[model samples]
Target: MKRFEGKTVLVTGGAQGIGAAMAKAFAAAGAGVVIGDIGDAAGQAVQAEIAALGGESLYLHLDVSSEADWQAAIGLTLEHRGRLDVLVNNAGLGPAPAPIEQCTVQAWDRIMAVNARGVFLGTRHAIAPMRAGGGGSIVNVSSIAALGLGALMEVAYAASKGAVRTLTKVIAAQYAREGIRCNSVHPGPIDGGMLHGVWSDPTKLERRLSRIPMGRLGRMDEVVAAVMFLASDESSYTTGTELTIDGGAAVQ
Candidate 1:
């Protein structure tokens, strides 16, 4: 049987990038997936692709920062998929790289709202259905920035992700007794999507690669596999921990 057969996964910011990738992977693994994102077109396209793959999925218009959106999204997930088995807090904001001094208040607030508060809201709302269903897993997509590796480039973004990292631990600890598992995945300069601009530039790309012992940026599938592990029964004993997928960047 497929790994996620009969399970339901809700992926936030699943319209594109790593979010879309995770949604497709979960559905292909046999989970009924909910693609939650503000980008309606891209989100629907991902849902369609999953359908073509013979996977079950639906797109939901969700602004992760909004509690109202979270309520509606979760409501729809239960109404359609029957139960919530996993919640992937994959939506986040990456502002242009700026030091703390240059990072405007507006940028900080916006980043925190989407990256930090959004994860908080998603986790908070998902707990009930997950508990009602007997158990669930929540995988928050943090960043190597949260570990101080990328802070020099984006202070606000790093701070926001730091919040995600700790928040994940809190959730894991409080919900373990209820059979809920919570973990965070920290990824370094991924090769495409949000980090494409960095990889697209020769100077920046070389600089990033030089910092990593692996000498290459991470891949989307690499991160996806890690998340799948955490969300699956394979990680039944794991909770309140972090898995870093940074190609040794954190060690350097």
Candidate 2:
């Protein structure tokens, strides 16, 4: 359904996994896409694949953790395509499991930089360009970890994502009257390589499943769909809300 037809989208972490899927999905729906990732090789490859599918796109190196990078990327997208209709703040990294006491200051800072501060920087740059173009959508990729007890892994990651969740609300409320919509999607235990050791063993899986009524890990495509909805006019009435695309994990 050409929901994003003729729009221009910027997806951070668009090199692979959920971000890659979201980039292709947006392009398929007729939006010109810009893939922003530190992984230059993978980002270019994804852009090539999208082009093969008859989609318009460009690939750029974006370190979301850097404010200057965010500014330059948005500036380039607008300077090249005229505007950015959607901003998907998808770049992030998960730290190893640790209690509050065990989390090194450096480790916590790194996770917060990418997961939380990245969203802030992306949204900051997107608003003005979007305002100039009449308005746009901002979708931040948060984690279901923000909604519950800290799992066996990544305490710092969870905290960082939680910050993103709250940050989304503030932006949404502040921009609602300005025609800018901001939302966050929470994913549960996606089957990406990044999640491998976090839920190690069948027992760990079972414990994880027990909390989710759907009884299975979330797929990257599922997360992409939710992000797409939030990114497009399809969810125009939605703002400041946390949409959990976690297969009922947050329900329990």
The Cα local distance difference test for each model comes to 0.92, 0.88
Per residue, candidate 1 scores C-alpha lDDT tens digits across 178-242 of 99999999998887778787778899888778889999989999999999999999999999999
Residue-wise C-alpha lDDT for candidate 2, range 1-252, written one tens digit per residue: 577788999999999888998899989999999999999999999999999999999999999999889888988998789998899999889657768898899988998889888898999989999999899999998888887656554788988889999999999999999999999998888877368675678887888888888888988888998899898887989999999987877767
In model 1, state the lDDT of residue 153: 55
Taking all chains together, the TM-score of candidate 2 against the true structure is 0.95
**Shift in Å, residue 228, candidate 2:** 0.8
What's the C-alpha lDDT at position 207 in model 2?
82
Best by lDDT: 1
TM-score of 1: 0.98
TM-scores of all predicted structures: 0.98, 0.95
Query: What is the Cα-based lDDT of residue 203 in candidate 2?
Result: 86
Weakest ten-residue segment in model 1 by summed lDDT: 147-156
